[model samples]
Target: MSDTLTPPMQSADCWTRREIWQQPQTLNETQRLLRDNQGEIERFLRPLMEKTNLRIVLTGAGTSAFIGECLAPWLSRETGRRVEAVATTDIVSAPDLYCEGDTPTLLVSFGRSGNSPESIAAADIAAAKISDLHHLVITCNPDGALARDPGTHSHVVVLPKATHDHGFAMTSSFSAMMLAALSILSGVAALETRIDAICQAVSDILHNADTAMADLAQRNFSRVVYLGSGVFEGLARESALKLLELTDGGIVTAFDTPMGFRHGPKTFVTTETLVMVYVSNDPYTARYDRDLIAELRADNIAAGIVTLSAKAEADDTIAVRNLGGACDADLLFPYIVPAQLFALHASLARGMTPDTPNATGTVNRVVQGVHIHPLNP
Candidate 1:
C-alpha cells in the first residue's frame, strides 16, 4: 500500500478503490463460506449429477457472463458433462438459441446484485424451455429477485453482503462469485490450501506491485489490448471491459487470445497502445504468450507491454507467487488481480470517478431500462 494512495474514506471514488483492495480478503471469506456450506451445496448437486445426459449452462450478464466462460472449460473436463457459457443477455433475447426443449439442464446463474432484468428472465426462459431445468444461483444480493424467486429445483448461494459492491463496477463481487462457483463445481480435494495460496498471491501483488501498476496507468496510452489463452480468454474479455468501464470509455480496449490477435486484432495495436498479456502456466500455452510478448518487444510499436504470469523469463514480468502449484483452473483467480488493479489505477490516472464512471447515467449499477418480455409457453 502506497502512502500517497488515497484512503478509502477520503478518496473521491472510495467505493471502487476500496472494493478493489478488499478482494483478497473477500476471496478468503468466500472460500470459508463455501466450505461451511459445502455439505448443502453437494447435497443439492448430487441428485442433479445422477441424471444422465446432463447439460450445465453457466449464464450471467457482462462480467458475470465472463465467469461462466472461465469455468466452462475446466468444469466440462472435470465433470465429463456438457458445460456451456451463455450470457443472460443472449438467453433473454433468444432463449431457443441456447436452451434445448428437453435437455436436463443445470443453469448456474452468477449475478452481483441478482437484480438485473436479464438475470431473472434468463432463468425463467430456461425453465420454460428445458423440461428438467435446475438452477444454482450464485449471487451477492440476498433480497434481489433472482435470490428471492421460488423457482423449482433452485438453490441460491448468497455471498457475504460486503461483496455487494457499492461501486458502479464489480470488484470483490465478481471474484467472490467466481471463487464460489469453482469451489462448488470443481470439487477439488485441497480447496482450502488452494484458497490460501491464491489469497497470498493476490495480497502480494496488491502490496508489491501497486507502484508499477500505478506507473503503467500513468502512461499516455489511449488504447489497451489484453490477451490470454484457453480459459483466460474469458478473463481477457473481463479485463478489457474493466478498463473500458473504469476509464469510462476514455481508452479504447480489445481482448483476444495471443494467437488470435495476429489474425486481425493485431491491427488495433499502435505506438499509443499498451498491451497486457495474461500468460498461462501451462507450458504449451505459455509458449504462444511468450512468443507474442517477444514479437511485441521486437516490433517496439506499442507504447509498452506487461505480462502477468506465474512463471516468466523476463526480469520485469509481474509474477504471482504462492500459487500452490495450482493448475490453470485454480490460477485464474490470482491472474485476474493485476487487471483489476490496472483498471482502478487507470481510472484514477485519467481523472475518472470509478465509483460512477458513467457520468451521463446511461450505464447503471444494476442495469436499467431493460423491459423483459413475458415468455408465452
Candidate 2:
C-alpha cells in the first residue's frame, strides 16, 4: 500500500509525507489490535492490581510520558492504588527523589523505541533502588533494550508491529500503548465489550479526522490551551505538545486542568487563541469540566472554544463531542488522536513537513544526542 493509504499508526511515511486524508484507517487498525489482545492482556494485568500496597508508576519520555499522565488518575481511582505518571527524564535526573521511598512499585514504562537513554536509565534506577519493583514495558519496538531485559519482574507487552509509526512524531504508537496500559489496569472482566466500543469510536474519528482538522487548521489561532481533569489532564499536556511539535511552534500551546487554568494560565487565552477541553465521564469531574467550558464561553477569551467528550451533552455544541462513552481513561486515546490529526493538518497548512515537522532537525524517530552515562552508585 502507498504510504498515504497505510494507517497512520503503521505507515512508513515520515511526518513530512503524510496527509490529513489518511488517519482513519490507521485508527481502525489501532482499535482492532487492542480488541484482539484484550483477553490475553486482562489475564496478565488483573493479578498485578490485586497485590497489596501496590504503587504504580507510569513513566515515558515526550509523547510516551503523556500516555502515563492520561492513565494515572483513572487507574488510581479504578484500582484504588497509588498511581503517578512520572517523566523518565524527571526520574532519571532525580532518581533519589522519585524512587527513594519504600513502596512496592509497579513501574510501567511507555516508549516507542524502548531505547531512549532516560527510559533505559530510569529502568536501571528503579531496579537498583526500589526493593519491590515490577516492570511492564509497553513499547512498539521488540528489539529495543527495554523489551529485552529479563533480570527484573518485568513483562514487555510489545504492541502490534503495525502500531510502530514511521513518522518523526508519534501517532498510532502513542494510542496503542495508551490502550494497552488502560487494559492492563482497567480490571474489567468483560474487557472485550468495552474494547469494541472504544475501537469503533476511534475508527469513526479517524474516518473524519483529516477533514475535521483540516478545517480547524484554517483558523488563525496563535495560542492553544488544552484542558482536562484527572487522567485527561495528562492527556491535555500530550495534546498541547503534539500541536506544538507538529506545528513546529507556529502556534504556542498550553495545557492545564480545567479548574487549574483559572489560577494563572487563563491569561494566555486571547481573541486569537483556541481552548479545547477533554471532558470527564464521571459526574463530579464533568461538572468541573462543564463549568470551565461555561466560563470560557462567557469570557469569550479565545477565538474559538472546543469541547471533546464521549457523550453529547450541553457542551457538545460548544465543543466537538467526539465519542459516545468509554471509561474516562480511555478517552485519552480519542483525545490524542485529534491532537495528532490537528498537528499533521496544521503542519501541512503551514507548508511544513508533518513527518519531520521540526525543520531544524533536532528530534527523530529514535531521538538522538545525550550519552547514556553508566550508573554511578
Candidate 3:
C-alpha cells in the first residue's frame, strides 16, 4: 500500500481517496443544506405524514438501496409511519407485490447519478400502482433524471456536488445520502442537535484510521465476514459490498446479523476468514453482538475478529472516541468510516484502482444493459 496515508495526502490524488476523506465535510454540508431547506421539506411532507395511514417507501438500487435499509427502522419509530425499505430492483421486477394501490404513499428515492434504469422504472411503477403517490428524490446530480424529471407530484433534494462520487465503490455518496434522508425524514432540527458529535467522530476516524486499515489490508485475508444487528446489519451489508467492489471480487465477503449468522451462514466462515462486527450502541443488541464475537473467538477458526463500536469491548475495538451515549442510529455515520477505509486499502493492496476496480467492465458505476418489461395485469 504505497499510497497508504502517512502524510494523509498522497501525491496520487485519487478520487476515491478524496471522496472517502471528504465525508465529514460532506455530511456537515448535507445537514446545513437540509436546515436551510426545512420549510420546503416540511411543506411537502407535512400533509402526507399527517394522513391517517401513510406509507413511506424508501427505494433505490445497489448502494442507494442500502440507504433505505439503514434508515427505515429508525425513521419508522421516529415518525410513527409505515416506513419500509423496498429495493428499486425488487419494486421494478414485481411492483404488484410491493406497491399498495390505494395507499397514500410517499416514495423517497436515493440516487447518486439518478440515471439507473431500475431507479426510474421503480418510480414509474410506484406511481402507476399507488393512487396518491408523492416522490422525494435525494440525489447528487442536479441534471440527473431523478432530480430533473420528477413530475409535478414530487420534490427533489440535490446534495452537495462533492457527494457525487467518481469512484466505482461509493464512499462519501453513501454517508451523505444517508444523512440527508435522516435529517429530512426525522426533522432536520432534531438531527441538527446531534450533528457536531457525528461530524467530529467521522473527522477523527478519517484523520486516524487510514494507516491501521492499510496495515490490515496487507494481511491478505481471502474471506471477510461483517456482522451486526438491526440497523447495523444493513451497515454490515454495505461494508461487505464496499470490500467486494473495491477488491474487484478478489476478496470474498458475507454480511449477516449477529444472531442470523448462527442459523447456518456461520458455515461460511473458515480459517482464512476475517470477521468484523459493527457493535450496536443499544445495550440489549450489543449483548447479542458481543456474544457472537465471543463465540467466534472461542472457536478460534477465523484469522481475526474486530469490533467497530462507540463503547470499548476488546483490545481490537476500533473506538469512535466520542458518541458513547448516542443512539445506534447516530452511530451509523461514524461506524461506517473504518469499513470504507479498509476497502480503499484492500483495493490498493490487491493492485486495483480504487476509483474503478471492476477491470472486467461487467459491473458499472451506474448499472447498464437492462430491458424494462411492460408492467401489465
Candidate 4:
C-alpha cells in the first residue's frame, strides 16, 4: 500500500482513490455551478431570510449530517441567524426535538444521493410540522426524491454528476455538498479564488503527503483519535467515520473537540493509539488546540501524534499552505483532504477493499433496513 500511494486506474479500489484525487477539480466545478445559479439561489433564500423569528436547520444522514455540523456554526456567524445541525435520522425519528411548528424555518437538506429514506423523510416531516417551512435541497442526484419531489416552497441545487460517488463511501459528494452550502449561505467574496487556493493546497498534500499518511496507516496502532475545534470538530467526526468505514471497523476510532477530549475521553489514549489534531487557524481556538497537543506530548500516551495546521512548526505537523489567511470556514475543505487519503490508504493497508469494505453486506452506500413510519395526522 505504501509502495502504491496512488492506486492503479484499474485497481479494485480505484474508485475511492480516484474520487479522492478528483475532489480538488470537482470542488472547482461545484463553485462554478453555484456561481452560475447564485441569483436563483439568492432569490429563493431572500424571502426565507426576511421572515421574522426565523430558524435554519441543516439536516442530513451520516456523512451528510456531518456537513451540517461543519457549516452550522460558520453559517450562523455569517448570516447572523439561528442555525442548527440535526441529522435526518434524528429528525425522522423525533421531529419535535429539532423542528417547531410556528417558527419560519429554513430546512437545508444535504444529501449525496438524495434517495436516502431519512433524507426524504426529514424534508417531508419538516414541511408537515413547520407551518412556514422552506427547503433548500443540496444534493448530487437530480433524480433523488428530495430534488424531484414537487413540494411547495422548495429549491434544489443539484451538483455535477461526478459527485454521485460510485464507491461505497462518499468522497467528492460530501465535499461538493459542503462547498455548495458554504457558497450559498456565507457569501464568501471571491469564493472561486479561495477554492483555487484550497485545491492547490490539497493537491500538494495529495502528492507530497500520501506516502507519509500511508506509512502512518501501516503502523500497528489499533485505535485512532481525531481532535479539532468548532468546524474541525465536525471534520474530526467525519475523519473518524471515514477510517472506521474504510477499515470495516477493524480499527477503533473516536472524535471530540480539543476541550471536550480532556473530560474522560482522554483516557482512550494509550500506547497503541494514534492521535491526529486539526489545529485551528483562529488564534483563540488554536490556544486550546495547542494546549491539548502540549498536554498529549507530556503524557506521551499515544503511539504517535500528528498535527495539521496552516501554521505548523514541527516535522510531525502537516502544513496546509496558500489559504491566503482564509477563515476557519474556508479552511475546512483543505483540512479534511488528508483524512480522506489516510482512510483510503488504511483500507488498502489492512488488505480490505476500499471500494466496498463492508464485505458482509450489513451496511450500504445508501443505508438499508430503515422502515420510515408515517407521521401521525
Candidate 5:
C-alpha cells in the first residue's frame, strides 16, 4: 500500500486487498482526470447528445458490465435520454437483437483492461450494425484494445493507471470505472463539489468496516445474498460477483432488488446464509429497502444481515460518513467498500490468495478461451 495509498493491515503482498483499499485514491484520481479532460470530452459528446434521439448503451463483461447496470436507470433519468445496460457478451452473441442499425446510438464501453474478446467483438458488432453511432471507451488500461483503437467515431477516456488492477478480481478497477462513467455521462462539473465527500466517505468505510467485515468472513458463511433498489440493484449484482469471484466460488452468491427478492428468491437463504443490502439513499426507494431488511430480520432465517447505508437513521448500518445528502448514484462508491473488503477477507480466510483467488485457470485476469465466432453475414 505504497504510492500515496493507505497502508494495508493485511499482507503487503496481496494486491487484491491493497486494490480494495486503494479505491478512495483511485476514485479521486479518476475525478481529477475527468476534470482535466472535460473540455475534450464535451467536444466529443455534445454533438451526439444534440441529436435528441441518441441512445446510450453501456457495455462490458462481468464486473465491467455491471457498471452499466448500476448506472443505466439513473443515467437515463439524469440525461433525459434512453440509457440501457447491455453486456458485451450479449452483444457479441446476439448482435442483431441488442444492436440497433437505425437509431443514433452512443456505445459506452467500460473495461478495466479493455482487452476482453467480447468487449472487442461487441464494439465491432455495434460499429458494423449501427449506422449512426459513436463510441465512448472508459477504460483503465491506456494500452488496452478499447483504448488503443477506439475506432474513427470514438473517444476513449483512460483512467489513472492505479485503477488497472493487476489482481485477478477487480476491486479498485470496478469502482473507478463506474465512478468515471457516472461523472462523464452525467457531467464532470456536477461531481466536482461532491468528489471530496465521496472520497472521504470511502476512506472512512475502508478503516471503519475493515475489522467487522473480516470478522464476518471468519464465520465462513456458505452463501451470501445482496439486495438493493434502483441504481443499487446493479451494484448489488456487482457486489455478489465480487464475493463469488474473490472466494473462487467457495461461497455461492446471489443479488436482487429488495422487492424482487420475495418472488421465490428469498427461499435461497438458510441458517448459513448472510444477507447484505445496499440501502438506497432515495427517500421513497429507501422505504422498500428498509422494509425488506426488516422482513428478513423478522424471518430470522439467515445467519446474519447487514445493511450498508449512508444514512445514520438505520440502526447498525455500516454507515458511510459525510454523504447522507448525496444522491443514490453518489452513494454507490462508498457503499461498495465494505463488500469489497469482505470479499478480500473471505478469500484470505479460505486460505486462498486474494490476488489470484482462482485455483483453476478457467478464468483469466482478462478472460480467456473465448472464440469470437464470426457474425453471420
Candidate 6:
C-alpha cells in the first residue's frame, strides 16, 4: 500500500474521513439545528394534533422508516395516542392494510429528499382514502417535490442544510429529523429542558467516535451483527443498514432483536464476525441483552464484540458507557450516534465513500423508478 497519510479525495461539498474526525463541530451543528427549530416544528404539528380521533402515522422508507420505529413506543406514551411507524413502501403497496378505518390521520413523512416515489405516493394514498388526512413532512431538501407537493394538505418542516448529509447513508439528517418529530409528537412541555443534556450526550459520543472507529476499522471482519431490544432494535437496524450501504455490500451485515437472535440466527455468527449489542437501561431488557452477549462469548463465534450500555459497569469484553436518564424512549437518540460513526468509518477503512458507496447505483439518497399507480375505484 502507498504510504500516503491522507484520506481519499472527496467532493468539495462532501465531508471527508478526516472531517468525520471533527465530530464536535458536526454534532454541535446537529444540536443547534434541532434546538433552534424546535418551536417551528411544534407549531407545525399543533393543528394536526388538535383534530379528534387523531391517528399519527410515521411513514418513510429504509432508515427514514426506522426513525419512526425507534420513536413509536415513546411517542405513544408521551402523546397518549396511537402512533405507528409504517414503511411508505408498505403503504404504497398495500394502503388499506396500514391506513386503518376512516379516522382523522396525521401522516408524518420522514425523508431526506422528501421526493422518494413511495413516500409521495403513500401521502397521496392517505389523502385519497382518508377524508381527514393531514400531513407533516419532515425533510432536509426544501426543493424536493414532497416539500412542494401542492396536493398535500400538509406542513413541510425542512431541517437545516447541514442536516442534509453528503454521504450515501443518512447521518446527522436522520437524528435531526427524528429530534424534530420527538419535539412535536413527544407531548413534552418544552424541548429546552432536554436540550442541554442531549447536547452534552452527543458531544461525549463525538469525542469518542474517532477512537471507536479506529478500533472497529482495524477488526476487518467478514460480517457484523448488531443486537438491540425495544426501541434500540430499530436503531440496530439502521446501524446495520448504514454499514451495509456505506461498504457497498462489501461486508455482510445483520441486525436482530436480542431475544430473536437466539433462535437460529445466531448461526450466522462466525469467528470472523463482529457483534455490537445495545443493552437497554431498563433492568429486564438489560438481562436479555446480557444473556445474548454471554452466549456469544461462550460460543466464541465472534471475531470481536462491542456493547453499548447505559452504565459503564458491563460484564462484557467491550463496553461503551452512556449513563443518562430513563426518561421515556427518548434515550435512543444520543445512544445511536456512536454506531452511525462506527459504520461510516468502517466504510472508509474499506476505501469506500460513505457519501455515495453504491457503486452499482441500485440504492440512492433518494430512491427512484417507482411509478405511483392510482388506487382503483
Using TM-score as the measure, the top candidate is 5
Candidate 1 has its poorest 10 consecutive residues by lDDT at: 1-10
In the predicted model 6, the residue pairs found to clash are 167-355, 168-355
Best-performing candidate as measured by lDDT: 5
lDDT for predicted candidate 5 compared with the true structure: 0.90
Taking the tens digit of each residue's C-alpha lDDT, what string does model 6 give over 1-377?
11112333434324534443333344445455656666766676777777656899998999999999898877887787788989999999998899865788888899888878998888888888888888888888888878888265677777777666666777767777787788767643455466555555655555655466667777898899888898888888998988888788988999999899989988889888888888887887788888888888888868888877755464643333344455535456557766776777777688776777888888767787788888989
* lDDT measured at residue 105 in model 5 versus the true structure, 0 to 100: 97
For each candidate, what TM-score against the reference?
Answer: 0.95, 0.87, 0.97, 0.95, 0.97, 0.88
In order, what is each prediction's RMSD in angstroms?
2.6, 3.9, 2.9, 3.1, 1.6, 4.8
Compared with the true structure, model 6 gives a TM-score of 0.88
Please report the TM-score between candidate 1 and the true structure.
0.95
* lDDT tens digits by residue: candidate 1, 64-99: 999999989988988888999999999999877888
Model 2 misses residue 336 by how many Å? 2.4
Higher-ranked by TM-score: 2 or 4: 4
lDDT, each prediction: 0.86, 0.74, 0.89, 0.86, 0.90, 0.74
> Model 1 segments beyond 4 Å from truth?
1-13
* Deviation (Å) of 261 in candidate 5: 0.7
Q: Give the per-residue lDDT of model 2 (tens digit) for 285-327.
A: 8899989899888997679887777776764632324344556
Task: Tell me model 3's lDDT, rounded to 2 decimals.
Answer: 0.89
Q: Between 3 and 4, whose TM-score is larger?
A: 3
| CA-RMSD of model 4 | 3.1
Name the regions of candidate 4 deviating beyond 4 angstroms: 1-13, 188-190
> How do the residues 1-377 of candidate 5 rate in per-residue lDDT, one tens digit apiece?
22255745545358887788888788899999999999999999999888888899999999999999999999999999999999999999889899989999999999999999999999999999999989999999999999999897999999999899999988889999998889988999998888888888888888899999989999999999999899999989999999998889999999999999999999989999999998887888888988998899899899999998877664755988778788999999888888888998898899888778888878789998999988787
Q: Which run of 10 residues does model 2 get worst, by summed lDDT?
A: 15-24
Model 3 agreement with the true structure over 1-377: per-residue lDDT tens digits: 11222237665558888888888788988998999999999999899889969999999898889989999999999999999999999999988899999999999999999999999999998888899999999999998999989866899999999899998888889999999999998889999999989988888777777788888899999999999898987899999999999999999999999999999999988998989998888899889988998899899899888788888765646888779899888999988988898998898888788898989999999999999999897
- Give the Å error, residue 275, model 2: 1.0
Error of 6 at 337 (Å): 2.2
Model 2 clash tally? 8
